[model samples]
Target chain A: MFAGLSAFPLTPLRNDEVDEVAYAGLIERLVAAGVDSITALGSTGAYPYLTTDERRRVARVALEHAGSVPVVVGVGALRTSQVIGLARDAADAGASGVLLAPMSYQPLTDDDVFGLYEDVAAAVPLPVIVYDNPGTTHFEFSDALYARIAQLPNIASIKIPGVPAEPDAARARVEQIRSAVSDRVTIGISGDASAARGLNAGCDTWYSVIGGTLPEAALAICRAARSGDAAAAMAESDRLQPLWDLFAEHGGSFRVIAAIAELGGLVTPNSLPLPVRGLDRTARDRVARVVRELGLIPPA
Target chain B: MFAGLSAFPLTPLRNDEVDEVAYAGLIERLVAAGVDSITALGSTGAYPYLTTDERRRVARVALEHAGSVPVVVGVGALRTSQVIGLARDAADAGASGVLLAPMSYQPLTDDDVFGLYEDVAAAVPLPVIVYDNPGTTHFEFSDALYARIAQLPNIASIKIPGVPAEPDAARARVEQIRSAVSDRVTIGISGDASAARGLNAGCDTWYSVIGGTLPEAALAICRAARSGDAAAAMAESDRLQPLWDLFAEHGGSFRVIAAIAELGGLVTPNSLPLPVRGLDRTARDRVARVVRELGLIPPA
Candidate 1:
């Protein structure tokens, strides 16, 4: 179920509202490029900013566009009840699975952590994928906790943040996790810039944020990686690295999504929530130059 | 509106439900102890874990118990709609003001940051205090951004996290922000342990997490400080340093909250979220010893 590329699409907002037409176009482009599965309302999708109604609308639009492709909905909320409610909504909306993060408020104890997963898993009939993005949630699931959570039948996979620049250390940690949960769950590496090392670490699924912005390029890399073509995967990663770096240089995940949305001409007057600054003229020029060099789009 | 010790009381949970009885008792204690104000549903109160109904119930309880004491309710949410709705609820529930953190999702742009305050301020008639707890949000509102947001009429105060020991640079940053917005906004320092330094640096309010667990001791220290009794304030702080150290020694804010909650006998089986391991026995013993030494609680 988790063998190929999963594109976590960025939600398109136009003038403070969800632009369904642009969202459908983004989804259609990803599906055409051979994305195996799609995730909506993830970090890139600005899931937190979305109201319950907006989340349902986006999920429905994504599902309509996916048609046959499996669509996983991001269902993280600070409260377990809200998350469970969203999970039910996602399932009702015809989602194949839900990407759940631990409760983001209080730091959860191991028991609390496991309980959170159990609550969500029990609340929905669809399979669940644990998303460990400490960068946003400020909580990282340890290997032991993951191992324990993996024993739950409903948890189908995990999306681990891609390893840092140190490939070997990242590979080792992934290997340890793989060894512990190999029988129970699939492992997907996020942070597309380091997807190559993740594959080397034995991860089979690649969750791509870039895929949301550049579906063809993202799919090509995933396809190359799946076929055991390390060189091509690395080449694709190298080409995409500039965009990733641009996101990092600006700030982190949200800025990157906003930048991508601006680039796609899908959202205008794009903005992030408080505390995150937007791309400046310098950052915009850098992204434009990279896009031009990569032949992804015409120069701005 | 901005002076003395402010207590961010814990939201009591009984049988996995909101314990309004216990919460009201806690608020009564803070108010009786001469706490300048009480903040309901802050991070210390586990606001993020509470359902909207639970949050409203707790806010109601705090307001009822507060009587004439000003109760500032925390109203930050990942979604703008949720925040607006919560702010309205808080105002309707009779909270004196709303303490808001920038939306916690991806980092926010200056426009997004200002927009959040402007929208929240406009949505509720009550005064608003801009909360800047970067430790949890992983995003810092720049002095420039804070300056702009502070210009809004309802934006009455700023809660900056206390200076970390390292990056001695934060002291200067705090001063710079104070310089820009001090006239328009009163600055509140978050960490009780850092209150002495923060006060010296021009912070007018000491918003206390530790105060929730040790109301009398915290108030004594605040009163001492307000009256220019630095020696007494330092002495009380010295007594509390080990507990603060326990928080710093482990996971910053998460560990501190969990430790204090355990000590106060508020929540049994207290635990933090993932990535943050709970205090080990050794750390727990140290905290216990400090609590005892400071006469923070009676001997068992």
Candidate 2:
């Protein structure tokens, strides 16, 4: 369950509230796509933008619609107690695991981050996926820290950012992590742009962003790579180069994926929580054009 | 209202909830100390760790006990709509101004940040303080963005991180920001250790951490600087050099200040919100010893 492709579906918001209907539909799409796992409230789900009650509901909503697939809920918060509460909520809501990121405001020390994982892990029985997305949380996880955390109770996976693009370097990075972590802990790759490279390089799973909204395209790359068809995986990834470029051209995957979800009718217009202005019309038009050109939009 | 010594009080928590009584007492202490301004919910206040209702109550408590002193409320959040709501709460709670930090979870674009200030400024009637503490928020504000956001209505100040240590360099840095921002926007210096240098360098305010708990020590620095006694200002700051070193040794001011507050019998012990482990016993002993040596603990 920890290996293979984990599709992170957008928890689309409407009227500044979780649009349950739209969110349920997005989850249903993922279930139908046969994603190995459904990770709700990952960065793509705008977890930090949500309130505790809202996050609980979103977790419950995801589990309800996730069918038989394992569901991992992102329960990262700035406070350890809050994360513990969310982790409990995820467990209560029947999530298969919880994703824990040391989300920071006042930059944390090494002990601070380690203690967060230790406390949360000790508090919850559900499996914990150590989230290492520094781009958003701005908290870098040292290798020693990773090694230390992987020994904690209920730790199931380590979701690292994109690997070094060089294939050998990526492999070295993966091996280094694999050697550090408990053998039971799977290594998952985030950063959708580098999913193929990461998977091809030895990562056991792709904890994806684009896969959240456009599962078919991501599945093409994942299936190819998982089947040992590295060239075919690269080729599949290359086919969607335009969409990847959109992610870079805009900023990160968050807004571009949001635009994709909105333009592809997976979400309502302006679906992103505020402060995050979804791409402007011109940018959205560009995203829509590329998404259409790539045939990412589902046929009605 | 945005200028002079803006003491940032700790909204100390007990048992995972805002310790409102302890909080109100902290505010009263600041009021009695006659701080130039009381900034509730600043980084030292652990605003990001708090819930909206907790934040609202903290703001109201500060205002209620602040006597005639101006109370600047930190209303920063990850979401724009949430900030808008908090800014409204600040206004309704009778805040003198709102301190707006571009708090990030998903790394934000310059446009996204500017739009946040634009939206919040439009939605609130109170003055706004542009809080540029990259140490906590991890969102760097460029001079161009500062110049841009400072132009928005109700922008009363820009609270920047510590300036360059060198007097000439600090002055130049201050001058550069002064040149960029609107004449109405005062340039306040955070980073308590650099308050004297920044204030002597022509920055308008000291948005201080220690000031919230040990107001007299900060007042000495603030008063000497404001009175143009540059040598005296530096000397007074030098007096607390021991405390400042603790801040550096501890990685940041948040935990150190919480330690000070707890040792001085201001807040209950273990006062900070969770995930943020307050200073360990050894560190707290060091903090307590420094507080005693510096004469920061007020007479019983």
Candidate 2: DockQ? Answer: 0.71
Q: Which numbered prediction scores highest in TM-score against the true structure?
A: 2
Per-residue lDDT tens digits for candidate 1, residues B170-193, read 457667887888486788888666
Estimate candidate 2's RMSD in Å. Answer: 1.9
Candidate 2's residue-wise lDDT over A159-221, tens digit each? 998799888998999999999989999999998889999999999999999788888888999
Give me the candidate number with maximum DockQ: 2
> Could you give the interface RMSD of candidate 2 in angstroms?
1.3
Q: Each candidate's fnat, in order?
A: 0.39, 0.73
Candidate 1 falls in which docking quality class?
acceptable
Alpha-carbon error at A60 in model 1, in Å?
3.5
Cα displacement (Å) at residue B159, model 1: 2.2
Stretch of 10 with least lDDT, candidate 1 chain A: A269-278
What's the chain B TM-score of candidate 1?
0.89
Worst 10 residues of 2 chain A by lDDT: A291-300
